[model samples]
Target: MAVIHRAELRPTKLELLAAWLPGRRWYQGHADADVVRVAAYRFDDPAGAVGIETMLVSAGDGPVHQVPLTYRDAPLDGGDDWLIGTVEHSVLGQRWVYDACGDPVYVAALAGVILTGGGQAEEFLEVDGRLEPRETPTLVSGSGSEGADVPGISEILRVIEDDPTLVVTDSVQLAVVRRLDGGNRLPGAALTGTWNGQPNPMPLAYVSTR
Candidate 1:
């Protein structure tokens, strides 16, 4: 379960992304355009120290984007390459934010979800010193691993394409799909999850063995 804080965040999420999105190679919108958050989901970290979130946003009239982010109380080691920047949380103080792809905690949590039939983190909003169950507009579930010691590198598909290029071999297992088509079923997903409003399961990430 994940606790949702109703408190304020300095520089807000969108504000941070607005300044950073333009530099991303995969971002397809005008970086200066006002970004609108469309939907989001979360995955829980077992240790409860890291906050993992994936936000879907739209800049102006462009296509929706999937941005996975991880929040930490301290700076992540060797994460400057993927760091989105930092933010101040009213309840948690200073937080170090980074692209989820570079965080081991986020990667492991996602792998755990795929290996174990796990659902998206349950959200409870804190209100007036009380906790209230909040319904996530989008629900996600993962495909569990079969009884096998599968090892691979988990890859995030930055660009959504019509035909996803995935190659799963004895030494590699790839899962890739960004723009999900409800009609097409993903292949060789160690884990497959569905969005609440969509009829199909979207490939969360691809795991490739080394």
Candidate 2:
């Protein structure tokens, strides 16, 4: 399970993305356009040491983009290239945010989900002395094998593309959907998700190598 914190974040997520997204090679937003978060989902770290989230955002009415982020208490070694900048958390103090694709924890969690056909992480918020379920606007699931060797590398598709098929093999461990489309169709083994705007579950990405 993932805990939904009620703490504030200095600079805010959008504020950071607004400045960072324009510089990304895969960002499709107009240079001057404003961006907004459309949907999001999370995956739990079994050790509970990191926070992982996939944010679906849009600039104006343009295509939705996926930005997977990982939050940590300290800088990730050898992940300087993937750093998305850091933020000050009201409750957690300073946090280092990085592109989830480059984080080992995020990569492993994603691979495990695909291999086990697992669903998105369950979330709970602390209310007035009680733990209340937090509702997510999206539904996500993964499909793959559980008995294969874990892949050592993972590539994240940042730009949104219009492909409904995923090609995979035992040697190649994963294929991530760069952009999601209207069609609810997908080919071969993969991960799928459905949100408010897109009711039908569509392929999000693919994972293999157990």
Candidate 3:
């Protein structure tokens, strides 16, 4: 396991969002919009290098969008724009804040971590070196694939939909639900996840990559 450094005494999950939400493409608002975190969860890349989270923030609109996030100690080599902004945790007492999903390190770690289980795997290479991956089903959900539930991962992937049937992989467990308002993708967002099974046993969303 790599030694991942995280600031201690981090802000409330909601407070983090107050600071983080304005920077997302999925986020709909002007430069000065108020964001309210409806809910959130925490997770770690399988390799433990990337700290991950999925948050559902309400822009005060009727729609709550899924905002997948990752956190890192340093700036991603190719992701200066994806970074929302960095801040020293008022509680954690450290500096250097960044959105992890924008970083190649987090995406690569997520890819490996997500497919941690199964007798088989569907390999995906990130697009443009971002997280935009060609997701082909490696193991159908319910294949008894097990992985570490790094706390808020389910909270992150969930909330986008309310489904009783959840999708599980070696790394992630997600539930297939359609985007109610047809959530839009980021301009730089480039990735796809494919589930290989008869009749497509998992819900695959059109996560567009520009």
Candidate 4:
């Protein structure tokens, strides 16, 4: 399960994305337009140290974009190239945010979900020393079946940023769709999701063996 904190964030997630999105090669919207959060979902880090989130956002009335991020307490060694920026979390103190494509933990979790037909993590908010179930604004699921063998993914060999961000892992390759459209029927296990105005499931990411 993913734990939620009702704390404040300095230069909020949307603010950071607004500044970062335009620089992305695959960004299809105007650079000066305002970016708004559409919806989001989370994946759990088995070690419970890192926070993984996949956010959907839009610039003005432009096409929706998919951005997967990972939050950590400390800098990811040798990941300066993928660093998005830092933010202060009221409950977690300073956080080092990075593109999930460059984070090993996120890669492993995403691969596991796709290969095992898993879904997004269940979320519970921390409220005055108690846990309260929180309804997620988005829902996501993988296409593979339960008990499917998931290869161990420890490192990212390469990352190609494009309309579909391609991440080459130690044992497999992941294609993370940057722009949200109708689902893409790729030749691999895929992760699909649905959010607010989007009732039909759309492809978010795909996993294929090398």
What order do candidates take by TM-score, descending? 4, 2, 1, 3
User: Using Cα atoms with residue i matched to residue i, what is each candidate's TM-score against the true structure?
Assistant: 0.79, 0.83, 0.45, 0.97
Candidate 3: global Cα-lDDT?
Answer: 0.40
Per lDDT, the best of the predicted structures is: 4
Give candidate 4's root-mean-square deviation (CA, Å). Answer: 1.0
Candidate 3, residues 123-189, lDDT tens digits: the string is 3333443443343323322222267233233112222223212223333433322222433332211
The residue-level lDDT of candidate 4 at 203 comes to 90
Q: Show the lowest summed lDDT stretch of 10 residues, model 1.
A: 156-165
Position 204, candidate 2: lDDT: 74
The lowest-lDDT stretch of 10 consecutive residues in candidate 3 is 201-210
Backbone clashes, candidate 2: 2
The C-alpha local distance difference test score for the whole of candidate 1 amounts to: 0.68
Evaluated against the true structure, the overall lDDT of model 2 is 0.74
Clashes of each: 8, 2, 15, 0
Task: For residues 11-61, write the lDDT of model 4, one tens digit per residue.
Answer: 899999999999999898899999988999999999999999998999987
Poorly placed runs, candidate 2 (over 4 Å): 145-172, 182-188
Q: 102-140 in candidate 2: lDDT tens per residue?
A: 676777777777767787899999776678999888988
| Candidate 1: clashing residue pairs, number | 8
